[model samples]
Each structure stands twice: as C-alpha cells, then as structure tokens.
Target: MIRNLLVAALLAGSATVADAAQWNFSYVASVGTISGQIDGTLQGDANTIFVSSLSGLQFNGTPGPALPFLASASSVVGGIPGPPALSLDGSANNILACSTDTVSSGCTSDGFAFVPAGFFAPPPVFFSGPAYGGAFFESYNAANWSITPAAIPEPSSWTMLIAGFGLVGAVVRRRQVVTRAA
Candidate 1:
C-alpha cells in the first residue's frame, strides 16, 4: 500500500513539470479601433489555445516582434479611432483597459505578460471569419512551447528516484510486520 502511494505522488509531480504554454495572435484591420478591441464570435464559441509570442512584419514594416497585444487600435490596419473593439470569431475576452509603451530599444519589449486592468490572451480561435474578405484573423504569432520534447524525461527520472525510496520503505515495513506476527 505504501509503495503504491509513493508511486502516485512521484507521477503527479512529474506531470506538472512537463507542461508549457504557447501564445498566438492574429492581425486584423478595417474593423478595429486605435484604443480598445472587440473580437466577436462568428459561429458562437471559440477554442482555447496557449500563447507564447507574436511574429510577422508589422504595418509600419518594423520586422522585429510585431504587435504584442491583439488587435489594439495601433496594432490594427489603416488605424481606427480610440477605444475601438476588434471583433473575433468566438466568445471574446471583453477587455476593459489596454496599453503598451513605444517599441523602441529600452521601452520595447518592456512588459508582455497580460496582467491586471483587463489584459489577457484568450484561447486560440480558428483562422475563419473575414475582415477584408480574406483570412479574417490575419497575421499574429504562434509560439509552440514544449518540454524541449526532450527534457520530458527529467520528470520521469525524478519520479523513479522517489519511487525507489518509497519501495525501500515498504520493504522495511513489511519486514517489521512479518517479525511482529511471528
């Protein structure tokens, strides 16, 4: 019984160490504001996806690290007015506040983590819906974060080590119980 409990604990710890989140985004215009975004759902719902980074050349042609935030007024194409909402293909995150500093050297890449004030990345939505009659969810980023697809073994190793110790304890317990019975 003790041995089984030990093995279960080890396995649980290993599983957590083997997970990573991938962040992605899509660029859209002709239906966004320069301030807020309102991504509406098309078929009624959206699928959840992980996020990590944003890629592709931006509107201004500054190739490095495109818009970090999804469909911000400044991130949209053609530039819309302030407090605009970028419609989506599913249930949206319904943001209340959003802002980013200038992407120039020191200030650039400052804070990418979506934190308080209604900033966050919703799960991945399909590339459906049409903005300019094309792939509505235009350009964004899809960062795949895995356990290096290799370090995944580290967790298993830890589990084995712990389980080995537990086995030893179980053996010692059994011996004690047997001696007491005799």
Candidate 2:
C-alpha cells in the first residue's frame, strides 16, 4: 500500500514539472494594434523563455515578420511579481524591429521599442519610421498591455497521471483479490 502511494505521489509531482502555458497578448501602439501568442512554461521566474518566441503576431491586421532572437531581459511574463501582464522592452539593448510591409524579410529601415519607465533613456516609449524614403519618429505611451494565462498540461504530464491512476487501480485490485481468497 505504501509503495503504491509513493508511486502515485511521484507521478503527481512529475506532472507539475511538465506543465506549460500559452499567453495571448494584445495592446495598442503608435504603429497599430500589436497582438500575438506567447508559448512557454509558466513556472515562476522562468517565463523569459517565451520572450523571443512569439507566434500569430500581427500589426493592425497584417501579419508581422518572423522576429529575431529578442533579449529576455527586455520582457516579463507571469513568472514574476506584478500584475498578470506582459511587459516588452525595445530599448537600445533590445531593438525590436517593427514590420510595416509584408514584403520585407527583416527590419532593415523601421523599428520600435518599449523603454520601461525609469529603465532606459528618457521619453519612455517611441516608434520609428519605415525604410521606404519617408522617415518619421514619434513618442507614445503603451497602455492596456494585457497578458493572460492559458495553460495546457504537457503530454508527459497526462501520461504520468494516467499511469499513476492505473498503478493505484492495480494495487487496489490486488488487495481485493487477496482478501477474497483469504
């Protein structure tokens, strides 16, 4: 009986390790509405793993280009203290390229960044201009930055849970069989 309990406990614990989450983020910016899904493990203080890897990214209504490796330090997820929100930094250290057109493969001429208050240089936030001859730069504040938790148990987690239940069921069945024979 103790062995079965121990096995169940270990399986339950292992499921926690394989837990994962997906956060859908959206907010208005000077350029347009920025939105995407961030996929990563929701384990506390380790949420930076989802910073650079953004999916379903869109600007206004157009799809954004594939992003390069962004700095994890410039972003924050549910793994830290504060409101359940996602904060992205596009400071000089983390220059995030703003995709303006669907044809460009990279951020050759345009870029934007979110400089957290009191973190980098002054003026808080700003958006840069496009590379197609017309140059423009403007400063704006980013508000309503929403980051919500959408969790899904990993496959290994489900497997471990099912196996644990099966093991416990077997143990109970064996006990019943022994009692009936006696």
Candidate 3:
C-alpha cells in the first residue's frame, strides 16, 4: 500500500510539469517597450514552442489593442507583411514579431519586431508602428529581447503530495505495531 501511494504521488506531480508552460518576454522597441507572457507547450526543439495565446502584452508600459491569435511564428519587417519566420524562437537569435490585426491582414496595421544581431541589417534593429495605420513607423537602434520560463505549482498539487506522505506513514506505523504484537 505504501509503495502504491508513493507511485501515485510521483505520477501526479509529473503531470503538472508536462502541461503548458508560461514564458515571459520583454523588449525595447522604437516606438516603445513591449512585454508579455506566452503560454503554450514546448515543441520538440526546446528553443521553440507553438504559441497558444498571450497575456499582459503591453506597449510603452501601456496596454495596446488586442493581438490576433497567431498560428505560428513570423517576422515584423519594417511594418511590411511577411510569413512567420523565426518569431517564436525564445533564444532571441531570430526576429520576434507580433501583429495586432489578423495575420491574414498583414502586419502593416500595427506590429512590433525585435531583431537581434545578424538580421537583415546590422545591430540596433527594431521595427514598430501605431495601431490601425496611425502613420507612426520607425526603426530604432538598440533593442533587447529576453524570454524565460516561469512555473508555479498549483495548491492542489501540494495537498495531494502531503496526503500521499501521510498515508505512507500511517501504513508503516500500522505494520510496526503488528510486528511488535506478534
């Protein structure tokens, strides 16, 4: 019984680790700074993850328009529309872009891109523009990108773990009492 409880607890704990992960990203852009959280499952390549959704996405320390759900990674090239190149690479070695409008409509409406070294041009590369074509587009110098994973276990997880340990202790204590009586 104690062994079964131990195995059950171990399996339950691993389940939470396998679920979706939360990645925090932040970068300074020409127009302003952008920061947000990406939630999704990591792909085979640890550096990339298929984006499921975004939260806390802000521009210049203020919230911006809602971004269209992206199917995959892409690029933000001078406010020009293009495919999702290496946008989702968390390593920051590739271009990372986000679109406010539907991806099908193009990134022209409103979007931001973070370009690391070895991009189309040299260093100091970033593309940003206003929403709904407000006529505010600029490529500024010096952009930084940081993406890291953050995880917090749920309260239920702790409760289950503690209960499992308690059960194991009770079984061991009962066995000791029986041995002494015999």
Q: Evaluated with TM-score, which candidate comes out highest? A: 3
Q: What is candidate 3's CA lDDT for residue 125?
A: 47
* Candidate 2: tens digits of C-alpha lDDT, residues 1-182: 77877887777667753344676766565456666776554435443323435567666667665443333223431122222123432222222434443213323444434433443445554443342112233344544465665566788788888888887778888889989999
Scored against the true structure, residue 49 in model 1 reaches a CA lDDT of: 25
Q: After superposition, how far is residue 86 of candidate 2 from its true place, in Å?
A: 5.5
Q: Give a tens-digit lDDT track for model 3, residues 1-182.
A: 66765675574454243243777777655445677777766666666665566677787677866555453223433454433322344343333334545544435446554444444545434555564223233343433556777675666766776766776667678778978999
Question: Any idea what lDDT model 1 has?
Answer: 0.32
- 40 Cα displacement, candidate 3 (Å): 2.0
lDDT of 1 at 28: 39
Worst 10 residues of 3 by lDDT: 132-141
Rate residue 147 of model 3 by lDDT: 70
| Model 3 local distance difference test score | 0.54
Question: How would you encode candidate 1's per-residue C-alpha lDDT over 31-137 as one tens digit per residue?
Answer: 32111112222222333222222334222232333334443223222233232232233222221111244422212232121111222223332121121122233
Q: What lDDT does candidate 1 reach at residue 95? A: 18
- Every model: Cα RMSD to truth: 13.0, 8.9, 6.5
lDDT winner between candidates 2 and 3: 3
TM of each candidate vs. truth: 0.22, 0.47, 0.53
**Clashes by residue pair, model 2:** none
Clashing pairs in 3: 73-84, 74-84, 74-85
